[model samples]
Target: MARELMKGNEAVAEAAVRAGVAAYFGYPITPQTELLEYMSRRMPELGRAFVQAESELAAVNMVYGAACTGQRVMSSSSSPGVSLMMEGVSYIAGTELPMVLVDVMRGGPGLGNIAPAQGDYNQIVHGGGHGDYHSIVLAPANVQEAVDFMALAFDLAEKYRSVTVVLMDGMLGQMMEPCELPAMLPMKTEFPDWAVTGAKGRERRFLTSINLNPTQQEITNLRMLNRWAQVEANEIRYREYFMEDAKYAVVAYGSAGRISLSAVRTARAEGIKVGLLRPITLSPFPREAIYQASRKLDGMLVVEMSSGQMLDDVLAATRFTVPTEFCARIGGVVPYPDEVLDSIRNLVKGPLTTEGHPRDRWLKRMAERN
Candidate 1:
């Protein structure tokens, strides 16, 4: 209602209540513990339902059960726990259920430490579950955007009648920021008559992805692909800053995007022509925006917490008309301003720093502290 200090996970929880989420089912996991904590308190206040299922696996299935009734539901977890939920996500997507999931990512191919990381980018955006289904993935750069994006995720999920996700990291979830969310909008979405709720007078309806008939399965796959094409036509979203008169473009998302914004401004002030392109929607990613940037800039620099995830999309969008450079920080560290600015300077630069480079200097500082 009013502006207040909140963490990114807290904002997601608050936004869930405001988005008219009918049910929440989740199990505990770190980096996202606050999200569950917030829901534990607020879901009761709204007379809604909240259940901590036996495990992440069960929690996701519970969400599936609720969504089968055509109720809006959500669940949240970290990397390891989310891996367990993959089986259920596949089921939900195969049946084409409309539900939202929040993933506060941490490092790993396994049970990693409780720190921020973007290693899940491919898994979250590329459909981690088996099969050919993609979730509508939203990437938010700050606490405010995180709150705003989660609301958007709900709308898209129900609109496409598909699963959607808000992909964020530990920095956003654990840090504090100002937020003023609006009043909860009343949701009035309905299940199609084809949906199998109970089947009273007509023939019984079924919800299953299994089609033993090859021809029928082909028909279903093509239909889903067509829907994805329609979504791709309308779903790309992005934000740009100081790029109208830019010689170079920088592509980044989430907290890295925010850091890149400051670096672009800093580079400009130092007489180097640099600008930023930040993607808000990771799936059907902001391709058109990237193509527009490539038309004007010489080359674009792609930065991320993990190696080469977002860059792949940038290259696909631009198709190599412009050269690209990449810089990344793995294992949960934010990209330093100097490293980004140094990328600009390497090709074309202004005499601003006589002290080698900012990232090298910062890394040494980190080494000393450790």
Candidate 2:
């Protein structure tokens, strides 16, 4: 396929269409609105279903309804909009329905801004929706990655009968890059046996997130847990850069990962033996890989566009075996490559300790710098 210069959100939307997405339901929100706009035009042209719902709540529920029929379905929104859909997201998870969601994250604790940010790390990766269920989350660093993960998202969702989230910051959503999209896939013709399509020919089937009896609810929860175990074993994904011979490393994801990569390269040129670990899957979180990397490192630096959310996960994975430091630019501010390079320089300078919380230390450093 010939490569085309495309905006991240539109490219991902087209990727979903080519992946045979049968229906799309979403509301317009900045940084991610282009995705919905693309779907509105393309879905109808392909004779597929598309709905620009009144609100995120309505959109997610519409996705929920379509998913129950065993068709490929999805929804997209920015940070605050995603919050509105949390309840419906939980309902979908509890029912073990297969669906995909794209979260083009923006700055926020509440109505922050439309700028690119990784602040949704905790919300999306840690199951923002109320439930004991887990969603498979994919973080893409660039437009190419954002485009490619769209098909994989649907495949994984259906494979595990779970929700799959393509998590990206607003920068990735709005930036333009050259990428080759996948070939169009045929729409699914055979519905799953569990589908709630008309029951005229077969036995009437039912699916619900509600398990009234306590024992039944427990059983449902157990089933979801067991399935998640399979996901953890088989789905962990991450990318390593220049780690073949390194004494120190940087951990980051999504756009932050992309930025950190540049810093790592510059640091390498300056005789700093530092590499990058960019997580591709945030849920089945490359824990084992990080643990192994920690075993060989003197210290690690975590870079983020948020307030060190993923840093906590890295700390747990490494079990504090290696001294760790953190640097971040939260609330719509993106850290420059030079800033991360400076952090790398500091990481090599020593006095790094595994004592108190990395965030606490980072806060002190940030305060001093300001």
Candidate 3:
């Protein structure tokens, strides 16, 4: 495929069309407004359904309704907008409808700002919606990955009959980069009998998130858990950069991983042994990869745009067996390559000691700043 320079959001919208997404219902929110805008124009041109919903809640519910007909459906939003869509997301999950959501995240606690940040880590990965459910979360570091993962997101959602989220920060969404768009995927041929598409001369079908019967709901929850376990076993994805012979490592994802890769390259050139472990799948995190990588490293640094979200996963992956350090930027601030390089230098400067938890070190740093 020919490479084209494109903004991440635009690439995602186009990718969805080529991936055969039948409908897109979304409300505009920055850093991802371009996604909805692109879909609005292109989906209409492609003869696909498109709706500029009045609110995120309405948008997600529309996704729910479209998905019930077994159509490839999607929605996009930033942090606060995603929060508004949580109730609908819960319903979608409970009902076991397959759909894709793109989160071009911005700084947040509450309408924080229109800047890149990984503030929605917990909300999206750890069941933002209620009940025991998981979303297949893919965090793409660049425009190409964003385009590629947008297609993968739909495939996985259908394969698992669950929500799949492409979690990109605002930086990736707004930045223009060269991307090689993938070939168009064929529309899904196997439609479930449960899909509600006109029951003329056939039995009626119904899909509902509500399960008033306690025992039946428990059974449903158990089934969801089993499916999640299957996803974890088969769907973990990540990239290891210069891990061989490295004594120090930095673990990051999304745009932060992109920046950390540069820091690792710089550190390596300076005779400081550094590598990067970038997780592509955020929900079924590459825990085994982190563990194996930590085995050879003297220390690890987790860089993030938020205070420390994926940092927890890195720590979990390391089992606190390796010394881990954290460097973060929040409220629209992004840590530069120099800042990551400094953190790498600081982490490897001292003697390696596997002492108390990494959180203590993070807290000590916070205390010093305060």
In candidate 2, position 117 carries an lDDT of 94
Measured against the true structure, the TM-scores of the candidates, in listed sequence, are 0.91, 0.99, 0.97
Between candidates 1 and 2, which one is better according to lDDT? 2
CA-lDDT, candidates in order: 0.83, 0.94, 0.91
Candidate 1 lDDT over 1-370, as tens digits, reads 5799988898889888888898999998999989998898899888888998889999999998888887779999988888899999989988888889999998776786888888889988888899988889998899999888777888898888788989888988999999888688886467666566787888987788787898987888788888888889998888998888898888999988887888888889998778889998898788888997888887677878876777778877887667677666778676788877776666464332323433454356446747
- Of the two candidates 1 and 2, the one with more favorable TM-score, higher being better, is 2
Looking at model 2, residue 279 earns an lDDT score of: 95
Give the best candidate by lDDT.
2
Candidate 3, residue 28: lDDT = 87
List, residue by residue over 300-322, the lDDT tens digit for candidate 3.
Answer: 99998877778878888888899
Better of 1 and 3 by lDDT: 3
Worst 10 residues of 1 by lDDT: 350-359
Best by TM-score: 2
Best of the two (2, 3) by lDDT: 2
User: In what order do the candidates fall by TM-score, top score first?
Assistant: 2, 3, 1
- Model 2, residue 294: displacement in angstroms? 0.4
Candidate 1 residue pairs in backbone clash: none
Backbone clashes under 3 angstroms, per model: 0, 0, 0
